[model samples]
Target: MSSITLYSLDGCPFCEKVHDALDDADIAYETEWVEPLHSDRNEVKRVSGQRAVPVLVNENSGVMMAESDKIVQYVEQSLA
Candidate 1:
């Protein structure tokens, strides 16, 4: 199992951005596709306290956060 997990939604630009960053950095991560409706994203909310896509959870480092730019920066500075 990968140490990182990305909560994402298909066709979401922000989610794609995070995915691309992880791919470019060659970081192996598991993708958990969330619901299309915000109300249905309970798992995301449970983890990050929000229903936002592109939320990343690094189990090994015990880091959980949202936002694409932040996640990309983290990948470059830490994971990559």
Candidate 2:
């Protein structure tokens, strides 16, 4: 399985949807909460070029994508 990482924040319906998809698919992912505790969130900003939740990073393919639907589709494809 590929290494998947997700940057998420609380109270985001989109992030919750992505999380639900991952859980439904039984896919494992590392999560990083890009909250205020993160002083240096440059990686998240760099990957997305902005602060966004549910930032899916595919380490196997070195691809970073933002957008719940796209992220879900990419996860499905990667798992397949």
Candidate 3:
């Protein structure tokens, strides 16, 4: 089993969308909540080069990306 990391923020609609997609696809993922000063949002930004919510990090495949559509597509493809 590979590991998937999702960087999200509470109450973010985009992040919620991604969460639903993951559940629908039956994909298991670890999540990191990005808050103003509560967590390491900068680390995610540093790695992805963009401080965007719902960043999906596929550690197994060494892929990191933002955007809900792309994230869902990547997840589907990776699982397949």
What are the clash counts of all predictions, listed in order? Answer: 0, 0, 0
Per-candidate TM-scores read: 0.97, 0.79, 0.83
What C-alpha lDDT values do all the predictions have? 0.94, 0.81, 0.82
Compared with the true structure, the alpha-carbon lDDT of candidate 2 equals: 0.81
Expressed as tens digits, the lDDT of each residue in 1-80 for candidate 3 is 54888998889898999888888888888888887553457877877887778898888788889998898787677763
Top-scoring candidate (TM-score): 1
Candidate 2 on 1-80: residue-level lDDT in tens? Answer: 54888888777789888988888889888887777444566678977787767798878888889999998897677764
Q: Residue-wise lDDT of candidate 1 within 1-80, one digit each (tens)?
A: 99999999999999999999999999999999999999999999999999978899999889998989998999999998
Which candidate comes out best when scored by lDDT? 1
Candidate 1: list runs displaced more than 4 Å. none
Model 3 off-target regions past 4 Å?
36-40
